[model samples]
Target: MIDRSQLQTVLESDFLERSFPVFNSPGIKDEDVMIHSLGCSVWNTLGHELGFMAVVEGPAPIASGNDIRSDSVWFDKADNTPLVLIEFERYDGTDRGYGKLEEKLGNLMEASMRWGDQPTLLVLSAWSPGLVSAPDFERLELMFRRGFSNSKGAKIPAPTNCQLLLHRLVLSESHTGLLQLQRMNFRWS
Candidate 1:
């Protein structure tokens, strides 16, 4: 098992190189490609037959609820009006998070292109590595591990900007993992 520092480094690095495409075109059926891609059949990098991605509609916004929060995130309240909001879910109780993140990232990039303002806020919600042991955890954990160091002579302030939340739930035969997540809110000004 990788240590916390190594995991953080891997995740941070991936995030830095990662870019989300935002698409904003009139009459465009797939206004949100990444979001729509959820449950859509696609090919993985290794050329494997993928399953349908899951998509979630406008998630109910409520303050003070299980796995919920109200914060100025993932939107440009300064100039760009409320154009759109994207909420990701982790289906299969894995790191995939309702939909494939790659598509969502692509969609974010598309949105950025159409909109004049750069992303101001970012909000990411997903289970953590140590808790979920998700398939994606290895990647994120690798990122985090390599980026940050508990050893002597390490840099301060990691690359990624996000917060983690832990939710304790009853364990079952099928589900035996802690609920961990990281939320990021993106916006433009």
Candidate 2:
């Protein structure tokens, strides 16, 4: 699997050049864009402030009974399409935690609506698994489908135009990380 530290470094650098603007609108002051440090929370480059609770910590599931924190970076499309919500799941677990994944997805859907008409793109990233099975992956895929449908059907506007993307990162035998991107889009009636 890819070294977690190396991946984290790349993400941090990418955020400043490509991901900081979505949350750092002109109306909001630079001080308002709180970024938490990598351990259990997100931080700005200076490592000074705590971001929105849900953005730093994954949304507390109304029912999942786990308030696990997630790593997310919010940014607007430079082309002005909408907001991009990126959630990174770099678990050291042998089996990827679908529960945490669902909770993060839930948070992204709720958070995106607050950004107005801007459509949201939720991306889930992860590392290679040591003990995950084909069945487990299948189950996670089905769960994601259900979550995507329900999130689209939320009381928000039907035409919010939200989309979902799964960015899978796997470490090969050569210790190089392979990137795979998959897309999912849904709209509620």
TM-scores, in order shown?
Answer: 0.28, 0.40
CA lDDT of every candidate: 0.27, 0.39
lDDT of 1 at 173: 24
Q: Which candidate is the best by TM-score?
A: 2
Once fitted onto the true fold, the runs of candidate 2 whose alpha carbons sit more than 4 angstroms away are 1-82, 91-96, 129-131, 134-159, 172-189
lDDT tens readout by residue for model 2, 1-189 = 112333345544545334444222321111222211322232323122211113444332343223323355433323433244456554344334656565555555544544453534455554333323222444444444454444335442322555555544332221233222111112211
Flag regions of model 1 displaced more than 4 Å: 1-78, 81-86, 91-99, 127-131, 135-189
lDDT of 1 by residue, 1-189 (tens): 112333234333433123211111111122234322421211111011111121233222332222222111233234433222232333245444533433333333233223332332222233222234333434433333234322233332222322222111111221323221222222211
- The 10-residue segment of model 2 with minimum total lDDT is 180-189
RMSD of each: 18.7, 12.8
